[model samples]
Target: MAPPLTPADLTPALLRGALEAERTERGGLLPHRLPAWARAQNTDGQLTMAESQPSGVRLAFRTRATVVELDTLPTKRAYVGVPPRPDGVYDLVVDGRLLAQGSVPGGHVVTVDMTKGTFAHTPGAPGTLRFDGLDGTVKDVEIWLPHNETTELVGLRADAPVEPLPDGGRPVWLHHGSSISHGSDAASPTAIWPALAASAAGVELLNLGFGGGALLDPFTARTLRDTPADLVSVKIGINLVNLDLMRLRAFGPAVHGFLDTIREGHPETPLLVVSPILCPIHERTPGPGAPDFSSLADGQLKFAALGDPAERAYGKLTLEVIREELARVVAQRAAGDPRLHLLDGRELYGAADYAELPLPDELHPDAAAHRRIGERFAERVFGPGGAFADR
Candidate 1:
């Protein structure tokens, strides 16, 4: 049996990972992946939403606590016209095994009415998660917060002492990408493709994957340039296609500039540029992606591409177009930059694979799909002779 709850305070020196935590005036702590200095550059709602999601951020420490209690306020997103999205998932891992899993319903809720293309926000009540029946022997513990929510940690209390995980000289992999990389539809925070791949590669992860926010922003490029990193990757093309943000003329220069900024930090770092994975909806079609509620009445929801295929003649972007361009860009730059390489996202999850494990939302991969992508990435990116192979 687990030890009874104590009336004592339990403190775990918070492990920030790649996050920057700010103490709330209300005795809570809000974790942000982007540093305050970077955040001050733009007030874009997409950036704000993505950075606050904490897709790859978690709290880790060593503890002997048999019963752990954590209090937090989570800002879960909801769609007004559609059914409620699943509560963001939190996972409890002990000694590197999943010990428990739960979801918090309280905190704040952000409502998005896709039908009207509008949004609303409301405060949420505080909720607590309790994990008991641990072995009680001193062991490592990791609490992975919801990858798709904005959480304000109100308090952390346990039955014993807690301290940060000691660094073991792991390789640090820094990555940046769009919503798919941000853990959309992932079963849990750590199950995200990047996290899974990182574990397999034996690398410390610094995920800059932001939902709807990887538009090749200069500030993001600057952030990557400033941050210390051994290996780096930029998963480009998808967000730019979906958002219809730039034309081929501007796209080439923008990519060059993004990489130029990062090179300022680590000139010899093995840098990989990844194009978007195959999205059938935008394969031949251009986009300003839209929610497809056609299946909603039948209790399903998906996304559809809205831009016309002929728009390509006017410099509109599509998956195929982006893939071809990314290849050419890397090939041309490779002669002058041996450290630079390209990976077609389609190679990760292509037409054949999609035939077996299709994207559930027709945009984002489901949990099962996430596993497939992660495993493939580990084998392709971290395996011998891969883009990230040690020199």
Candidate 2:
């Protein structure tokens, strides 16, 4: 009789879609979207937390294992007085198709008090995810991590031997944007707009969509400049305006500098600069956006732009103002760099979209909107004659 198979030894090479894989002190593997140097340059807790959440990270291998198991430690987020958030999902993809979904039950929780601007952490036991009835044929397998949770990979077991999947030599598409691009409200990791777009366009995706952290930091720009990519894009303007991070004087120069830095590494790469989509709350109103506490008290979460509409005269940014600036920047740069291109954010989602599929939270798009955006992006950006199209 044949002996039973054992757990396959795991290493960082087994991971794809992440920039770095750090060995955790607890003998686990932690995937980081940003490298250590980039992370070390920031002190913001929110950015720290957002980048640690592996939105597009996944394990890719080729195996004939009929049953596969993964042990993980996931860090979940909670809000004081609010209902507990749903457990993060684990998506199983077999040979490029989503086959099943699972979840880890316990690990850790970071509870935040929005009213007090405070947070605390509670540790819990790790959980295991099991996938059964996979075909015995040796085929590609991908375990997509949760997009909204910070996860540490502990162990991997299968009934048969496994090895890292060979690269398919597809072009890499590196994209950077705000939480909307971070898969906010998407049903699963693969459902995120960028992922969907990449799948449709037949490319590999490297997503740098950090929630509340897309403020165009120098380190982030540097990271983008340094990363290897066959195609590159930066979705700008939303986070900048919503955060009220800078005034018009700083906005232009900062954007110019960011693009300059990226050009340092990819001078002739086809680069697309996308503006923010139509967000009614911030369409005309400047922001320093704030959460609607009244809605929160009713156990619902919503956002409101706190800045006045008239603030545009003072150079306070509204989405409208941002779109104009982004257009101008791309137009000016494209004159010198023919590879540079711009896509008006409204082209993806505009007033007509708002009338049909309104942003439920007054900010982020819902699952359906994500699909719409993803499909449109694939058709407009990756199709023939599109900016990033294969010429």
Q: Quick one: best lDDT, which candidate?
A: 2
In model 2, residue pairs whose N, Cα or C atoms come closer than 3 Å (at least 3 residues apart or on different chains), thus clashing, are: none
**Candidate 1 per-residue C-alpha lDDT over 151-193 given as tens digits, one digit per residue, 9 for 90 to 100:** 8888777778777867758888889999989989889998999
Residue-wise C-alpha lDDT for candidate 2, range 1-391, written one tens digit per residue: 4335578877998998899999998788999999999999999898999999999889999998988999999999998767788898889999999999999988999999888889899998889999988888989999999999999999999988999999999999999999999999898899999999999999999999999998889999999999999899999988888898998888988899999999999998889999999999998998899888888777878899999888789899888888888888889988999999999888898999999999988999998999999999999999988988972
Task: Evaluate model 2: give its lDDT.
Answer: 0.91
RMSD of each: 2.0, 1.2
Q: For model 1, state the Cα shift of residue 105 in Å.
A: 2.1
Model 1 TM-score (2 dp): 0.95
Point out the worst 10-residue segment of candidate 1 by lDDT.
7-16
Q: TM-scores for all candidates?
A: 0.95, 0.98
lDDT of 1 at 145: 85
